[model samples]
Target: MDEFSFCDKSLSYEVRVKDLIDRMTLDEKAGQIGDTALGVPRIGLPKYEWWSEALHGVSDVGQAGNHVTHFDDVIPGATSFPTVILTSATFNQSLWKKIGQAVSTEARAMYNLGHAGLTFWSPNINVVRDPRWGRALETPGEDPFVAGRYAVNYVRGLQDVEGSTEDDEVADLDSRPLKVSACCKHYAAYDVDNWLGVDRYHFDAIVTEQDMMETFQRPFEMCVKEGDVSSVMCSYNKINGIPACADPRLLKDTIRGEWNLRGYIVSDCDSIDVMLDAQKWLNDEPYYCLDLDCGYYYPNYANTSVRMGKVKEAELDSALKNLYNVLMRLGFFDGSPKYEKLGKSDICSHENIELATEAARQGIVLLKNANQTLPLKSNKIKTIAVVGPHANATSAMIGNYAGVPCRFTSPIDGFSKYGKVKYETGCGEVFCKNESLIFPAVRAAKKADATVLVVGLDLTVEAESLDRTDLLLPGYQQQLIQQVSSQSKGPVILVIMSAGGVDISFAKDDPNIQSIIWAGYPGEEGGHAIADIVFGKANPGGRLPLTWFYTNYTDMLPLTSMRLRPIESLDYPGRTYKFYDGPTVYPFGFGLSYTNFTYKLVSSTKTVNVKLNKFQHCRDLNYTEGSYKPPCPAILIEDLKSSCGDYKVKLEIEVKNVGERDGSDVVMVYWSPPQGIAEAPIVDLVGFERVFVGGGGGSVKVGFELDVCKSLGLVDFRGYRLLPSGGGKFVIGDGVLSLPLQINFRR
Candidate 1:
């Protein structure tokens, strides 16, 4: 092996991968296609497992069973941060990266102990297009910009070398050794798992090219181009008529050719099987060059296809090169890792545990704090009642795709730290179908100084393959909350512990329900985090990443309608905060902090001039008569591609904490395109930054620089990005503050 150039650590990954591919036989190349790679042992290449999961922690949920062990003597468990939806609520990119770093650290440590694999299929960056889609818990919510930013930061933290800067250039990624490999998964308009009679495997997502470019495909584009991710897992669903795994337009043309993805394309677990058996995509196409992540028949099929002249050996070599390149980047063939010293001690270290707690604290959204009824003084509140199925939750606190946590702190345990506690499961479970259980919960609430009703959906209510039918609380859970709140001795605090948004407008309008908190599967120390917020130990700053729509909204809207723009003639309200104009239970970016904060626009660019080239077609169009109005013709962004770099919008906003307590506030910037553009969003989030401001009179200045083409541009019906020539407004945080601007196109 030492005589082989592939064994040399100093050689480039490309050269080394090519050498290794040249040495391997046809059978050996086919064997390396699946998740369980059958290495060329004769050439000193050992077998490797390419499948593992680290969504929020070192999880053992992948095809490689128990890869990240918990029962082991040396390492007990990994630090589990809050699930992606909750984490995204924090609106903190730095925190997202930090959590990613912590998870990868434990992953590398586990790898050193030979307890885990280097490649982890994680950070599911699929936008949560619908609330009923069960896996919303795993995504960064409904915004494409947020999801894209999450992919970039989390991927960088997972793949970059331990000491490398977070802002490392994409050009440098190819040469650098990876700490661990991270894959952005379930690509290309894949949000559904199972809905009514339709499941992800069989359902075909009929999406318009405009909606695809504007929303569905934006995150994956960012994941590939900006994140520089090592791998992308095609979804089980079909985009239009073609299965995602088998679609060359998506996998080859878009991801590789256009985005220039410097990585391998792998199918979701058993997605190849789904395509062949369920979708019958293989029978019609008879293509055998697709990449498989996990399946039994790949090697045999590949060997058969190569002999039958169906697939070229060179094409097989090309795919193998990609697979081996990833392994090479992970230092698989380069001997022991540089951080080989990392072991059991690094798995659940104190710092990692603390980070988990902090993550939960930051992501807990305070939906309602009516009349400042929260922050129950521990001294005044002598006896508190912790009632609900999730009151003493153990595994429920950690949503799906979770591993063994380092420890657990139930809601009962957390509130007990402040005062004497009385506990009762309001319902036997989150299902809460039985009315008899509510009596005991109401009795306990009546006897306590304050009642914390920890009620909401669980995995049983919403999880993989379990799409919800309604947006309301399951069964009798809503009744229990109402009963307890109406009869409680003191203020009743409602705590929702689920992934998808609940239409809790009943409780929102109820005076009896003083406060409400959405703790979306806050991992491990979640209970403690919720208690801290309730007791004023931590200020709640998390905003809703996705809008909480009314129950009636789902009644009219079909989950299959992938269009994002509202169709007035059809009365289709559309999807997400970007387009939907209907009433909402809670709008996106809605969260109440313990204190108040105000935003003031300090400075901003009033006009952006896009100088078009001489040969462009749009430059010949006449300008409109009115001031700040668009021209007679629309200007496609492709025509002014070269001039995009010349125009940018820069602004500084001062956020002052006007309340009596210090707290964190997210400064969100939204853009409303020129009014005349057809099918444009109402307003969409462009940039956001979370900052901590001290008590009364304290202020923090936040700055943002947005490209005119990428940030302010509108996607037209033809799927082309168009720079509309007219006046627009940059809305800052909840539409209270805004700056008007004009975009002009000239030759």
Candidate 2:
């Protein structure tokens, strides 16, 4: 009985979960619920490594001793947080529980170095309807309370919570085990309008019960009622005609009978053979009738003409005992378990190249700086050219699941190793090789004095198995940044770099482009962190996680109004910026910061009551400003502070940094759902707070509650549900809520 009694025979989940459900054999529980695989019987009981992908770090191949820092082998660095819509515009739950404890400390250091545990299907709480979904850079935008508070801090940072804490120590996360297993994706609604990936299996999408309980069941009802999430998957699109992984009214009456979700559902990744091949057969329309004299038909459609035991067997023994109860609570057949190893290393040091150069200087965004051109001061700029075709390229800042990267450096080797630099290849390597290098990068920005340029899109012109048919900029690199900003004499700057969002409305309304910087890919020390933000030695701040479109992929996708529109016409005022009202070439938590701040507006109220033990401070909100200010101000906060004492209904604010120097502000709050139950977007984000405002000013007081804004619906037009209402409204703009606050300086 030593190692947990060697699997107590009959395949133990403690004696085969109720004696193998009374001696199984319903086709071996419908072949353990299809999407199957087995193979490791060398010994017994401990070998179920079903392929993994934590969406950003933690992809395993039969484990290696912990050494996890790759980034060049393509996508494997962790904790770059913010994306999933800039970490849902920092509505900080202590920065998404320290980015879910740095993604369960790099997925328990990739399962203590031998791998196969941290399952991570990931924080793609899917909502970004159609900003040309090439997998909306793996979602978290087009709000549902900012994808349900980034799916409850990424499912409490890849499931390690049991009283977690690191750097501060305390971590008993169930005696230190779980270094992965945080699924939650697609499951319901899963949207993406075009460039046809054949609509996840013959498209169905019709949605509406108030846009399916307000925007696709609001982040799967905050990933199973406030992130108790363990696994959910199920999507390759099909909602109305039912598919989301054999939608048994969405994995059993709303993620296990109305959010009692105790974890384990899994399917996405060949979504249960696209739900047994979208129920056996020819969905007609072979490109709208190639008419052979009126009698259209094509039948067969492969997969042994379907009917592999037409489903059931208690729905494949409840999706194989909900994926073997998440491999028996991640002890995965007992091989010592408690995070077995940790942060493995094979070399790539200097603290994993300084955590991929501080995750490329925290996902650099600064969209437009305006007059100050930007940081550059290094003794008042002296002859630096740099130019584009992603400057020195080495796979333009390692985007997409990148890893094995260590030596990248480029913007012409980070500005010719520092001084009087000059390099061209302007826009040469569009996706592979164009090489005219924009007339020697506009003759080295016509004898430069100040010009950075760089330019983007190169995962061979947009990634995730390529799809971006438009969002411009390629080969010609926007006419070589309008011919090197018409041969700049000073201030040209552009930077760009892609993986998503690249239209750059002509260098954001160019005026010889004073500055633009987007940096989304920035990995292998993203060109020495874009030459330390062009020499001023770091400060850009980074924003815009996705949404910079302006008519590219067929004038912003129409695909017959997105397949005859309906998944609630893609909810939230109808998708991104609350139902695309046009004219946005930049918006979606847009970002930029050299320095500035101020948001004052607070309290609009749709709900607030609070007392959960004297509502934990955030300027103990009550409200007063009612004299004729409707430009979108909020800060309700009635009483939330529950540990179970009870007293809820909350919202609160105060951001103030009035700039001259120190910066950082996210503060967004959006809630609004009550009208006929949920068509949302006059308000959607529920709360967000991120601060740091020195230079003689500062403020912070944030809060939110109302069962943290509920929704969890539709587990059966294509299944999964939770449907309460009356929760929505919030805005914080002053850098990005709507962008106004200015933060007056003069210290």
User: Which numbered prediction scores highest in TM-score against the true structure?
Assistant: 1
Measured against the true structure, the TM-scores of the candidates, in listed sequence, are 0.97, 0.33
Highest lDDT scorer: 1
lDDT of 1 by residue, 122-227 (tens): 8898998888889889999999999999999899889877666646665645655778889998888997777888899999999888888888889999988888
**Lowest-scoring 10 consecutive residues by lDDT in candidate 1?**
619-628
Over 1-747, each residue of candidate 2 has an lDDT whose tens digit, in order, gives 334333554354535544444454443333333222332233233333444555544433222333222333323334332234333333445555555555566656655554335555676777655655565555656666667777877677677644543233533322234446676777677665345554446667766554565567768877777776766766666677665555566667777777767666655554434444554423321111100001101112211112343333343444455566566556665543344545545224455556556556655767887876677777776778887777777644655544334366767777665668887776447652454767777777788888888776765655543456566666567777887788777788888776467677877787888888777666556777777876756666655645676654455344323331224434322345655545677877677777776665453334333222332332211122442222212212222112323323454555676767676666655443333332223444445556666655766655545343132111222222322222333445532343111101011
**Shift in Å, residue 305, candidate 1:** 0.4
Instruction: Score residue 364 of candidate 1 by CA lDDT.
Output: 94
Cα-based lDDT at residue 527, candidate 2: 78
Candidate 1 local Cα displacement, residue 248, angstroms: 0.9
